[model samples]
Target: MSERKVRVIVAKPGLDGHDRGAKVVARALRDAGMEVIYTGLRQTPEQIVQTAIQEDADAIGISILSGAHEYYFGRIIELLKERKASDILVFGGGVIPEDDVPKLKAMGAGAIFGPGTPTSVCIDWLNSAVREKWARETA
Candidate 1:
């Protein structure tokens, strides 16, 4: 049987108008054989989470370059938990500081990528993480 493609929701949470990086990662994931949904810019936490649920996404990749990574991600994860969709993997990228990485992960984010991190790194991690998430869910 053919394997199912991993579905990822790429979102720009908050007022961050710049989406070049998010777009790049979205395209890279699509090229990597995953189904990617790019939600454009200026999305709210509720919107992102709702879209993820509606899309039945296996993961959410949020790109925040406006220094509100903590707030946005925290709210998003909180909503996911409240809605009983916390199993959907949450990762983030874009202008994030190294020091804030641990905090974001502690807030239920799967991975946090700072500027200069390669797109391939994110893609590889997503492939492994998504598979592991599905495996755990099924088991």
Candidate 2:
């Protein structure tokens, strides 16, 4: 039987107007054989989480370059937990500082790929992490 392709919801939260990086990552994920849903910029936390649920996505990746990663991600995590969607892997990327990455992860973020991270690296991490999460869920 063929393996099920991971479905990911790539969203841009907040007022961050720049989406070049988000687009790049989305394309890379599509190329990596995952089904990617790229939600355009200016999405609120609720919209993103709702979309993830509606899409039945295995992962939610938010791209925030507006320096409000902490607030946005925090709210997203809270909503996910409230909606019992914590099993959905939550990851993000953008101009986040190295120091903030750990804090983000500590708050339920799976991974934070900083600016300039190779697309391949992000893709690989997502693939492996999603597989692990999927296996754990099924088991």
Candidate 3:
């Protein structure tokens, strides 16, 4: 099989207008050789999932910093499931509380990289996880 590039959609959902970190991470992922589609700020969960599907994305990485992590992330996951797009790896980062990371993960998020997490770490995880998920799917 030919090598396929991983495509990721980095989105900012809900009322969160902060996007410096999202833009930074988008550049980091692009520099790391991945296709990154930044959807800008104030996207709804429905819009995010639709973009992911339309782009044929390998992953969705949300950046939320408005302290509405649970509500937004949960809604995104639900929308992904509703669209039968759960196979696309879902992860995120932001100023989330320590107590909420596990809950997010348990709700089907591939990983949650909180504030202060390195950009390199996010890139590595995306590269590795996408490969593993694709391998499993194609096996």
Candidate 4:
């Protein structure tokens, strides 16, 4: 049987109007064989989570450059939990500081790719992580 393609929702939360990086990563993920949905810029945390759930996404890749990574990440994860959809893995990227990475992860973000992180790195991690999540869910 053919394997299912991982579906991802790529979103830019808050007032961050710059989406070049998010667009790059979205294209890269699509090229890498995942089904990517780009939510465009200035998305709210609620809208992102709702879209992910509606699309039955395997993961969410949020690109935030507005220095509100903490709030965005936390709110999204919290919404996922409240909606009983915590299995939708959440990751982020953009101009986040290295020091904030751990805090983001601690708040339920699966990963945080800072500036200069390669798209291949994110793709590979998503493939592996989503596979594991599926395995755990099915088991």
| lDDT to native, each model | 0.93, 0.93, 0.92, 0.94
Worst lDDT run of 10 residues, candidate 1, spans 112-121
Candidate 1 local lDDT, 57-86, one digit each (tens): 999999988999999999999999999999
Model 3 regions lying over 4 Å from their true place? none
- Give the range of the ten consecutive residues with the poorest summed lDDT in model 2: 111-120
Q: Which 10 consecutive positions of candidate 3 have the poorest summed lDDT?
A: 108-117
TM-score of 4: 0.97
lDDT of 4 at 5: 87
User: What lDDT is reached at residue 67 by model 1?
Assistant: 93
Query: Which runs in model 4 stand beyond 4 Å of their true positions?
Result: none
Clashing pairs in 2: none
Which candidate order results from sorting by TM-score in descending order? Answer: 4, 1, 2, 3
Choose the strongest candidate by lDDT. Answer: 4
Give RMSD (Å) of candidate 3 vs. truth.
1.3
Off by over 4 Å in 1: none
* Model 2 residue 31 lDDT score: 93
> Compared with the true structure, what per-residue lDDT tens digits does model 3 show for residues 37-126?
989889999999999999999999999899998988899889989999888999999898889989999998999998788999999999
Collision count for each candidate, in order = 0, 0, 0, 0
Candidate 4: worst-modelled 10 consecutive residues by lDDT: 37-46
